[model samples]
Target: MSERKVRVIVAKPGLDGHDRGAKVVARALRDAGMEVIYTGLRQTPEQIVQTAIQEDADAIGISILSGAHEYYFGRIIELLKERKASDILVFGGGVIPEDDVPKLKAMGAGAIFGPGTPTSVCIDWLNSAVREKWARETA
Candidate 1:
């Protein structure tokens, strides 16, 4: 049987109007064989989570450059939990500081790719992580 393609929702939360990086990563993920949905810029945390759930996404890749990574990440994860959809893995990227990475992860973000992180790195991690999540869910 053919394997299912991982579906991802790529979103830019808050007032961050710059989406070049998010667009790059979205294209890269699509090229890498995942089904990517780009939510465009200035998305709210609620809208992102709702879209992910509606699309039955395997993961969410949020690109935030507005220095509100903490709030965005936390709110999204919290919404996922409240909606009983915590299995939708959440990751982020953009101009986040290295020091904030751990805090983001601690708040339920699966990963945080800072500036200069390669798209291949994110793709590979998503493939592996989503596979594991599926395995755990099915088991």
Candidate 2:
């Protein structure tokens, strides 16, 4: 099989207008050789999932910093499931509380990289996880 590039959609959902970190991470992922589609700020969960599907994305990485992590992330996951797009790896980062990371993960998020997490770490995880998920799917 030919090598396929991983495509990721980095989105900012809900009322969160902060996007410096999202833009930074988008550049980091692009520099790391991945296709990154930044959807800008104030996207709804429905819009995010639709973009992911339309782009044929390998992953969705949300950046939320408005302290509405649970509500937004949960809604995104639900929308992904509703669209039968759960196979696309879902992860995120932001100023989330320590107590909420596990809950997010348990709700089907591939990983949650909180504030202060390195950009390199996010890139590595995306590269590795996408490969593993694709391998499993194609096996």
Task: State which candidate has the highest lDDT.
Answer: 1
Local distance difference test scores for all models: 0.94, 0.92
Give the runs in model 2 whose Cα sits over 4 Å from its true position.
Answer: none
- Stretches of model 1 off by over 4 angstroms after superposition: none
* Candidate 2 global CA lDDT score: 0.92
For candidate 2, the TM-score is 0.95
TM-score of each: 0.97, 0.95
lDDT of 1 by residue, 98-138 (tens): 99999998999999998898888999899999999999999
Clashes of each: 0, 0
- Which pairs, if any, clash in model 2? none
lDDT of 2 by residue, 8-79 (tens): 999999887889999999999999999999898899999999999999999999998999989888998899
| The candidate that achieves the highest TM-score relative to the unseen native structure | 1
